[model samples]
Target: MRTALRPHHLRWTGERDLAHAIYGTVVGTAAMATAGAHRTLGGTVATVLVTVAVYWVAERYADALAAAVRGPDRRARIGRALRQGWPTIEAACAPPVVLVAFVLVTGDLRAGVVVALAVSTVMLSALGHAAAKHAGATRLVAVGCATGSAVLGVVVILLKTFLH
Candidate 1:
């Protein structure tokens, strides 16, 4: 098999979208983790997806508006804003799949939720490390960034634990 194309290999965009990706992952994971147990798995998944989509749209809209104030082409600016933020949606795609797969195999929605949160936490750490390294941080700084991100994720999980 061919080697997987790393984000660093991208031409037009490297880790520029990492911020949005991290945000999306956090949003998705938090949504799944905190969704009440009364919700069916499908309902929880739908809620997570809709929540992410809404957040993405709201953020992009604000970006577009900011760009419009600085530029002349409103339509093109909006298009660019949406395109730039697409990584947010892409990043959120994995957690729902994890939730579904775990629920299917374990026959437990809560298990699926915790597993999905863990996966998102891992993604956040990796993204943080990549962002720091891309920014030319030292190795220790990169590791610190990753740890900080993971801690934030853990806090979200803990909130879910207390709430549920």
Candidate 2:
């Protein structure tokens, strides 16, 4: 049972970080693009990738810092922290992919932002539902939690609209 639980534990941490990075990147990109912060799709993609890398480094350092508080007797693996936070990079790819595809196919940056936001919202809901299931939530509770998580995505959309 203990061995079985370890993988689940690892996933929980990685998923949380991934979800956070996804939502942040989606919202940030949408807001910037809508506000005309980036003049080109290439520039927007660069900003998104840089944002993800910055967040990953911040989280990795945070994990190591927290572990350090527990002292040298329980050594922290800085490499493990890097590995655990790697999902952040994966999650950030969705927005750029959407942005590039829409820009190329439709030549509409606004549409790209909108579609990317929707994609990120869906991913957030899925992440939340999975998290609830991992916690053994009841069916209804899991759905409620998922909707709740999705609200964060909605907030991003609202901000983008207003910023635009």
Candidate 3:
């Protein structure tokens, strides 16, 4: 694996990770919009699960890229993978947690919870990306995730308002 993992290869992997994150964000938003249209607790749960799955996949990609860059030292590779993946995991969890809290607090199984979760995902993604950048990860990848998440959030809101 180390023999195949050159610096350029790592760079390309990072770029791909960014692209995947962007694509995942867009798809997740669309899924959430559809879920919001149903206005049911089950739909909300499904949307959250879908979004979380997308985020989990993106994080896995990021971890793989980090591992590729970290080389053959297993301990170092594991550490780098964790460092790269943790922020994304946290960011992804924030939105669902907020949604659940809001649902429990307000007892309203409506589109508002989905909207709030989408917005929270964007905000948390931005903060997570910033932290990842500060920790020496690829800035472009972080920015891409953050920007994509924000755009998706806006699109979700628009779809919920106009289409749903």
Candidate 4:
């Protein structure tokens, strides 16, 4: 019997998907954070979901098309594309949960948006650190990776503050 692979044993596809997820997270967080003042918490969350879904679909379609050109089994290529693109959609899951929870508890949509952005920033930082460590990066390099991911989220939040 084969033992299950450990989380640390990441394949190239896992790394690629992680990168996609990080990109998606940044996009989704930015979309909601920079939304207009008239936007409600639910509307912002829905917008994020729809934006990520559209991105996910577009990525999968492109990937599938590329695979179709290289292979004979269209169904398998489509399935592979869908699986590969799933992490991007999954990346959008966490921030909205934080948003909804904070909004429900504090009854403040703006505060919820702040909390959600913060939570997603932290998550991205963690993911960057893990990815770097998994690739045998030095501790300093891992920290730098984490900081870079965090800065992406922070920049978006800063833009929201200034723009809205």
Q: What RMSD, rounded to one decimal, does every model reach?
A: 3.3, 5.1, 9.8, 3.6
Off by over 4 Å in 2: 1-35, 73-76
Superposition TM-score, candidate 4 onto the true structure: 0.87
lDDT of 3 by residue, 1-164 (tens): 67335532133234334444444445544555567665776676677666657666667667766676655686677565554432333334445556667777888756456656466556636644654564576878878756755765776677767865
Model 1 over residues 45-161: C-alpha lDDT tens digits? 988899899999899888888888885687888778877766677778888898899999998888788888888898889888888888899999999999988886898899899
lDDT of 4 by residue, 1-164 (tens): 13224232243235676687788888888888766464687788888898888888888889888888885787887778777856576677789988888988888998889888998899789778877886889999999999999998899889889987
TM-score, candidate 3, is 0.50
* Superposition TM-score, candidate 1 onto the true structure: 0.88
Weakest 10 consecutive residues, lDDT, candidate 2? 3-12
Candidates sorted by TM-score, best first: 1, 4, 2, 3
Cα distance off (Å), candidate 4, residue 83? 1.2
* Candidate 3 lDDT (Cα, 0 to 1): 0.57
Candidate 2 accuracy as TM-score: 0.77
Name the runs in model 4 displaced over 4 angstroms. Answer: 1-13
Better of 2 and 4 by TM-score: 4
Full-model lDDT for every candidate: 0.81, 0.68, 0.57, 0.80
| Root mean square deviation (Cα) for candidate 4 | 3.6
Count: clashes, candidate 2: 0
Clash-forming residue pairs, model 4: none
